[model samples]
Target: INFNDIKEWKAALCLLRSSPNLVELEMLARPEEDNLVRPGVSFWAESNQFDCPFDQLRVVRIVDVVGIRPELDFVKFLLANSPSLEKLTVKPVSNDGGLDLLKELVRYRRASIQAEVIYVDP
Candidate 1:
């Protein structure tokens, strides 16, 4: 789904929980304002609490992810839940924390899933 607002994100997350046959998910977000600080751990914890239907998911791509805590949580959730996932791609917005985000990705890579992370220099 093309995420334009928080409402869209909420809806998408709900849909992901209900769709039992979901094989692939691609989340694209448009750039916006408001740099509110959200705790990444809480966001990830909440997402992990849900029963996501991603057991069959093989490919997940998140595009245009800004430095938002929710975005980081979302990536972390995908990494943890998508055991069968073969490919995952993330494109982060150019900002002060690009290197930090890359480090997090590297640190979270699963041994079972050969995750390839590419950060576009901006």
Candidate 2:
């Protein structure tokens, strides 16, 4: 799955639920400054309740990762749900907050103990 303009969490949740058998998922995004969607809207709001588990998900590659809350939340969601996930490769759009992103993602409690995280600098 390649999410290009995924700005809202509602949309993100819907897309995630639509694909229950994804082996690999990918997204196209830029840096935080050039956010694809408008700022200030929380993607992971409390009112939105979803329990979609990725039963067949394995690899997740998000291009031009910006480490925004929504982006990171999306990653955290996958890590917490995808039991079969093997690897997560993220290529940042810039050096700013790249390390921070890694730190945050690496510490997330992943359902798959074998899940490996890779951060690529551009």
Candidate 3:
């Protein structure tokens, strides 16, 4: 699922819950036009934990990742649950990070034996 703002982002999660056979999921994770509101929020996760096991999910590409709590948590969930995941590509909002985000993402426990987390800049 892809979202441009908070409302869309929230709706994306619901869509995610309903998509049991989802093979891939992507989130813009920020306002496409750079709206000042960032750093993420906790309320977006206020829902029942369906823990929808992504049996077919193989790839996840999140653009404009801000490394916020919610984003990080969602990434962790994917890593832990998506047994078929083969790759996770994160393109941050900028070419920053100093490799910190990459390192953190790599530390997550992926259910897939061949899962790889890649960070890119453009």
Candidate 4:
């Protein structure tokens, strides 16, 4: 689960999906040996599938999210799916549009859900 391979990441998601009672999900994506050959493609795709069957999930923390379309989509998906979600923490490595992402989430927060997003710029 510590590797950057796409297959491994997908497998992790499948495993996670099986757990319907998961209340918290944390994900960290690190490059393989500091190799920048790929520009966050693997993480992006994995993020898109972040919508697990965690009906009671309230916390989701993502660290080191690089600039990837799937990552953005994943965050949006979480905001839409996790009605009980209350907190979201994002730690970005660079200027990866983290603020804009949070704003979007805030804009879409439902009146019934008191969602708070804490963005830590790194």
Deviating ranges (above 4 Å) for candidate 4? 1-9, 31-52, 96-98, 104-112
> Which lDDT tens digits does candidate 4 get at residues 37-96?
256465633464555544677888988876445455456656656767788777776776
- CA lDDT, every model vs. true structure: 0.66, 0.75, 0.73, 0.63
Model 4 weakest 10-residue run by lDDT? 29-38
Per-residue lDDT of 39 in model 4: 64
Q: Model 3: per-residue lDDT, tens digit, 1-122?
A: 33335566567666777888899887677534544335554433443255567788999998888665666667887787788999999988876772778888899888899999989874
Provide backbone clash counts, one per model. Answer: 0, 0, 0, 0
Please tell me which predicted candidate would have the highest lDDT against the true structure: 2
TM-score of each: 0.73, 0.78, 0.74, 0.64
- Identify the candidate with maximal TM-score: 2
Where does candidate 1 clash, by residue pair? none
Q: What would you estimate as the lDDT of candidate 3?
A: 0.73
lDDT of 2: 0.75
Lowest-sum lDDT 10-residue window in model 2? 1-10
Clashes of 2: 0
User: Which candidate model has the greater lDDT, 3 or 4?
Assistant: 3
lDDT of 1 by residue, 1-122 (tens): 33334565577777877776777777775666653334333545476677763777777777777756566666777777776777777776565687887887767745236656556655
